[model samples]
Target chain A: MIGEYITSNTEIVESALTQSLPPAWQIPLPLRESMNYSLMAGGKRLRPILVLAAAESLGGTKEAALPVACAIEMVHTYSLIHDDLPAMDNDDYRRGKLTNHKVYGEAMAILAGDALLTHAFYSISQAHKVHGIPAERVLAITEELSAYAGARGMVGGQAADMLGEQGITKLEELEYIHSHKTSDLIVFSLRAGAHIAGASHAQLQALSQFGHAIGLAFQIQDDILDIIGDEAKLGKPVKSDEKQQKVTYPYFIGMEASEKKVRELTSQGKEALLQANLVHPERLLQLADYLMKRDH
Target chain B: MIGEYITSNTEIVESALTQSLPPAWQIPLPLRESMNYSLMAGGKRLRPILVLAAAESLGGTKEAALPVACAIEMVHTYSLIHDDLPAMDNDDYRRGKLTNHKVYGEAMAILAGDALLTHAFYSISQAHKVHGIPAERVLAITEELSAYAGARGMVGGQAADMLGEQGITKLEELEYIHSHKTSDLIVFSLRAGAHIAGASHAQLQALSQFGHAIGLAFQIQDDILDIIGDEAKLGKPVKSDEKQQKVTYPYFIGMEASEKKVRELTSQGKEALLQANLVHPERLLQLADYLMKRDH
Candidate 1:
C-alpha cells in the first residue's frame, strides 16, 4: 500500500511538473530545453512526496500541496544541476543519465538551474492563486522556502560541504554539513506540507522534529549504501565516497555504527511523528522505514 | 533634484542590502564572502531606484517598497554574477572591480548567485511580514518577479542573446533579446513597486508600457555607447560589443538611427506615464529622460 501510495503520488507530481514549465514556443528554445531536461530527468520524487504525505496526514488535499510540492522538487533539481557542475562536483551522470552540464553545456546548465530556482516561487504562489490556499499560508511557505534554500539553509549547507571537502576533522562539522546540505530541504518539504494543511503550531513543531531525524537518517543511509549498495540499483558505482576521498558517516564511524545510527534516527523520527496526533501517519511512518532501507 | 533623489534612494537600498544577507558567522565563511562580494559591489542601483520611484510616484511610502526594491536588486546582481562566469560572458571585471567568479572561484560564485536569487523572494516576503504590505500584493509581486526573472523573461532573453552570439540575422531578433533580457526586469521592478503602493489596474498597465519603452531605449543607448561612448566613464572598453561580435541595435541600423530610436522610445515612455493620472509622475517622467541621456 505504501508503495502504491508513493507511485500514485509520484505520478501526480510528474504530471504537475510537466505542466509547470512554460511551453517551448513561449521561451527561447535552448533555455526551455535546458530547464525541461533537468526537471524531467527522473528521480525518486521524495521531497514532493513528503509534502503530500505530510499534508495528507493532516487531512489536507493533494490539490492544495501539489504546486508547492513541485516547487520543492524544482529546488532540489536545480541544486543537483549546479552541484554537478565542473566547478563543483564535476559529476558526469545523475540517475544514470548524462548530467545537465554534460548535455546542455555549463552555461545553459547554470542558467537552467537559475531558472528553476527562480520559478519555484512562482510555483508556490500558485497554491494561492489556483488552489485557493490562503494568502497568509502561501506567504509563510514562501518565506520558509527562501530561508531553507538560501544562504542560511541548503546553500549554506552546500558551502560547508564544499569547504569541508578540504578536510573534515570533526564529527560535528560532518553533522553540520549533512544537516544543512542534506536535511534543510527535507525539513522545508515537511514544514511546507504542514503549513498547507493548516496544522497547529505544536503539530508543525512535531513535523519539523520528525523531518530533521529522518533527513539525517536518510543521509547516513546514503553513506552506508555508498560503501555497500548495489551499483546497478544505485544507477552509479558504489564506494564513490572512497573513490573521491569524500568524508562520510561510515568514513568516520564505520559501517556498523553508520547503520546503527540510521536505525536510531528513523525510530526517533517515527516517534516524533506518532506524537503529533494526526488523522493519518501510517504512510509517513512507512516512508521513514522505506528511506532508511533504500539502496539509492 | 533627480540626481539627489537617486543618490538618497541608493543609500536606502545600500543600507537594506547590507543587512539582507545572513551574517558571516551564520554561514560558511567562504560562501558568505562570495555572496557579499558581488552584492556589496556598487552600481547605479537603477532597479531598486525604479521600485522606490514608482512606489512614491503612486503615493506609496518608501518603507513598504524598500524590501521589494532590495529583492529586485538581488535578482539583478545574481544575473550579473552568472552572466560573468567563464562559461558565459567570461568577464573578468564588473563595476570597476573583479567579477565574482574572478575573485571567488566559479563554484562559489555560482552558489552565491543561487543564494541571492533564492533570498530575493525572502526579501519580498518581508514587505508583507515586516512592512505590513498586504499578503495578496506580496504574492502578486512574487508571481510577477518569477515571470520577469525566470526562463520566460530575463533568462529567456539571455538565452536568445547567447544563441545569437554565433550570428545575428535580424533586428527583430536583437530587439527580442534586449526586451526580454534587459527590459523584463525593468517592467517587473515598476510593476512590483506599483503593487506595493496598491496602484490601480490602469496605473500598472501604464507603468508596464513605460517600462517596455524605456527598457528598449536604454538598451539601444548601451549599443550606441559601446560604439562611441568614453572608455574611462564606461569602465570597460568601448566597442567591446563589436569585439564580441554581438548583434546590437546599431549593428543592424546605423548609430544615428539607434540614437534616434532611443529618443523616440523615451518620448513615448514619458508620454505614457504622463497620461496615467498619478499623484507624482514627475519623478518617473524625469527618470525616463535621465535613462535616455545616460552615458553609461
Candidate 2:
C-alpha cells in the first residue's frame, strides 16, 4: 500500500523536480550536465514525495509544495554527493552508479555539491513566487528548512557522527548523532509540508511529533538493513556501515531490541498522525509501517 | 580611502557577526565551538561590510541590512573553509591560524562548512521576518544570492579555476576564472545591498556593472599582492600562489600589464558608480581605488 503511494507521489515529484530545474543556457555545459547527473540519478524521491503526501493529507494542493519538495530533494542530493567525497564517506557508488566525485573528479564534485545546495534555496525562494501562495508563508517554510538543515540540525548531527566514529560508545551519544544526522531533515520534510499547507498550531505540533517518531524509526531500519540486507537490494554495498565502524541502534541495543524499537516508534508515529485528525492519515500510517518493514 | 571605508565597515560587520552567532544550548558544545572558530576567524569582512555600506548609502537602515550582511559573510566563510579542505586547496593555515580541517579534522571541517552555508540563508530568512521586509523582495534577494554563489557563479568560477590550473596559458581563460569567482560574490554583495534598500532597477544595473569591474579589480589586486605584498602586511604568507603554481593574473599578464589592468578596472568601476547618483559615492569610489592601490 505504501509502495503504491510512494510510486504515485514519486512520479509527481520527478515531474516537479524536472520543471524546477529548467536548464540554464548561461551555465557552462559541463556544469549543467553535472547538475542534471546528480538530480536525475534515480532514487526513491522519498523526501519530496513525503512532502507532497503530507501536504495533500493536510488539504493543500500538491502543486503548492512542488518547489519545496524539489528543494528538499536537492539538499538531500547535495548531502549525498558531499558525503561520498574522498574526504567524507569516500563511497565509489551511489544509487547503483558512480558517485559525483567518481565521475567528475574531486574538484568538480565539490563544486557540484556546492551548486546543488545553493540551488536548493533558489528553488525554495522561487516557490514563493509561484502564483498562489502567500509570500510570507513561503518565506516561513524556507526558513524552517534552512534551520533544520543547518548548524543546529543536520550539519550538527553529521559533526557528532564524525566524532562518534572515533569511539562514542554511549547509547545517548549515538542517538544524538542519529537525531541530527538522519532525523533532522526527515522532521523538516514533514514540517515544511505542513507549514505550506497552513497547518494549525495544534496540527503542526502533532505532525512534529509524528515526524520525530518516524524519523528515528527510519534510521533504525537503515541500521538494520545495513546489517541484514544484500548490496544489490540496498543499491550499495552491504555492511558498509560496519566497514566504517560507525555506531548504530543495533550496535547499542541487540538486533532484537532494535527491531522492537522500530515497531514501538512506528506505533507512536501512527498515533500522532491519528491524534492530528488528518484528512488522509492512512498513507502516512502505512508509510511508517512500510519504513520499518522494507528490505532496503 | 577605500581601505578606510572597508576597515570601518569591517568593525561594524565583525560585531554584528558576533551577535548573530550566539551560542545555542541545543547544539553540542564542540560543534558550536567549531562553528565559532571558523566564523570568528579574522578576515577583511569586505563582503558583509559592502552589504551594509551599500544599503546605508542608499538610505536603508543599518539594522535592516545587518542580517543580510552577516549572511553574506557566512556564505563567504563557508566557501573559504571548504576551499581549504584537503580535497580542495588543502591549506593548513588561514588568517594566520590553523585552517578548519587542520584544527577540527576533515569531517568536522566539512560539516562546519556545510552548516555555515546552510545557516546563512536561514539567517537571511529570519532577518526578513524580524525586519518585516516585503516577502517578494526577500525572495528576490535570496534568488540572487543563490545564483551568484551557485554553479553559474562562484562555484562555476572555482571549477574553472581548478581546471585552468591544469594548463591555461590564455589570458582570457584566466580572466574568465577570476571574473566569475571573486567578482561574482562582490557583484552579489553590491546587488544584495541595493536589493534590501529597494534601489531602482537602473541603479541595480549600474551597481552590478560597478561590482563586476571592482570585483575583477579586487582579484587582480589579490593576485598582485600574492607576488609583491609583504608577508607581515598581508597577514598571511605571500608568494604561496607561485608555490602552488596556481594560474593567476600576474602569471598570465606579467606584473606591468597586470598593474595597468588593475588601474583600468578601477577606473571603470568608479565610472559605473558615477552613474548612480548615490548619496555618498566616495565610499564606493574609494573602495575601488583601495582595491587597485592597496599593497595588501
Candidate 3:
C-alpha cells in the first residue's frame, strides 16, 4: 500500500514538473532544452514526495502543494548539475547517463543550473497566484527555502565537504557536513509542505525533528549502499566511494554500525511524526520504513 | 547634487550589504569570504541605487527599501561572479580587483555565486519580516523578481548572448539580447521599488518605460565607452570589445548613430518619468542623464 502511494504521488509530481516550464519556443531554445534535459531525467522524486506526503499528512490538497514540490525538485536537480561540473566532482555520469555538463558543455550547464535555481522561487509564488494559497504562507515558505538552501545551510555544508576533502579525522565534522549538505533541504521540503497546509508551530517543529532524523539516516544509507549494493539497481558502480577514498559512515564506524544507525534514526523519525497529531500520517510513517530498508 | 545623492545612497547600500550576510563565524569561512570578496569589490551600485531611487520617488522609506535594494545587488553580483568563471567569460579581474574565481578556486567561486543568488530572496523576505512591508506586496515583488531574473529574463538574455557569440550579424537579434539581458533587471528594479511603495498601475507602467529606454541606452553607452573612454577610469581595458571581436552597438550602427541613440533614449526615459506624477522625479531624471553621459 505504501509503495502504491509513493508511485502515485511520484506520477503526480512528474506531470506537474513537465507542465511547470513555459513551452520551448517561449524561452530561448537552448536554455529551455538544457533545463528540461536535467529536470526530466528521472530520479526517486524523494524530495517532492516528502513535500506531498507532509502536506497530505497535514490535510492539504496536492494541487496546492504541487508547485512547491516541483520547485524543490528543481533545486535538487540544479545542485546535482553543479556538483557534477569538472571543477567540482568531475563526474561524467549520474544515474547511468551523461551528467548535465557532459551533454550541455560547462557554460550552458552553469547557466541552466542558475536558471533552474531562480525559477524555483517563481514556482513557489505560483502556489499563491494560481492555486489560491495565502500570500503569508507562501512568503513563509520562501523565507525558509532561502535559509535552508543558502550559505549557512546546504552551501555551507558543501563548502565544508570540499574543505574537508583534504583529510577528515573527526566525526563531528563529518556529522556537520551530512546534516547541512544532506539534511537542510530535506528539512526545508517538510517545512515548506507544512507551511502550505497551515501547520501550527508545534507541527512544524515536529516535522523538523523528523526531517533531521530521516535525512541523516537517508545519507547514511547511501553510504552503506555504496559499500555493498547491486550496481544495476543503484544505477552506478558500487564502492565508488572507496575508489574516491572519501570518508563515509562505514569508514568512520563500521558497516554494521551504519546499518544499525539507519534503523534507529528511521524509527526515531517516525516516532517524532507520530506525536505531531497530524490528520493522516500513515503514508509518511510507511515511507520512513521503506526508506530505511530500500536497497537503492 | 545628483553626485551627492548617489554617493550617500551608495554608502547606505554598502553598509547594509555588509550587514546582510551572517558573520564570518556563522557561515563557512571560505564561502563567506568568497561571497564578500566580490560583493564588496564595488561597482557603481547602479541597480541597487535604481531600486532606492524609484522607491523614494514614490514616497517609500529608505529603511523599507534598503533590504530589497541590497537583495538586487546580491543578484547582480552573483551574475558577475558566475559570468567571470573560466568556463564562462574567463575574466580574471573585476572592479580593479581579482575576480572571485581568481582568489578562490573555481569551485568555491561557483558555490559563492550560488549562495548569493539564493540569499537574494532571503533578503527580499527580510523586507517584510524585518522592515514591515506588506506580505502581499512582498509576495508580488518575489514573483516579479523570479520572472525578471530567471530563464525568461536575465538568464535568457545571457544564453542568447553566448549563442550569439558565434556571430551576431542581425540587429534584431542583438536587440533581443540587449533588451532581455540588460533591460529586464532594470525594469524589474523599477517595478519592485514601485511595488514596495504601493505605487499605482500607471506609475508602474511609467517606470517600465523609463526602465527600458534607459536600460538599452545604458548598454549602448557601455559600448561607446569601450571605444572612447579612459582605461583607468573604466577599471578595464578599452577597445576590449573589438579585441574580442564581440558585436556592439557601434559595430553595426556606427559611433555617431550609437551616441545619438543613447541621448534620445535618455531623454525619453526622463520624459516618461516626468509624466508619472511622482513625489520626487528630479533625482531619477538626473540619474538617467548621468548614466547616459558616464565615461565608465
Q: What lDDT does model 2 reach?
A: 0.82
lDDT per residue, candidate 1, B258-288, as tens digits? Answer: 8999999999999888878899998898889
Q: Where in model 1 is the C-alpha error above 4 Å?
A: none
Tens digits of lDDT, candidate 2, A94-164 = 97999988888876777787888898888877666764677777787778877888878877777667666
Mind giving the per-residue lDDT tens digits that candidate 1 earns over A242-291? 78888899888898988999999999999999899999998999999999
How well is each residue in A37-74 modelled by candidate 3, as lDDT tens digits?
99999999999999998999999998999999999999
Residue A121, model 3: Cα distance from true site in angstroms: 0.2
The list of candidate 3 runs beyond 4 A from truth reads: none
Model 2: lDDT of residue B286? 71
Give the CA lDDT, 0 to 100, for residue B55 in model 2: 83
What value does the lDDT take at residue A201 in candidate 1? Answer: 92
lDDT measured at residue A110 in model 3 versus the true structure, 0 to 100: 97
- TM-score of model 3 relative to the true fold? 0.99
Question: Residue B1: error of model 2 in Å?
Answer: 6.5
Docking class of 1: high
lDDT of candidate model 3 versus the reference: 0.92
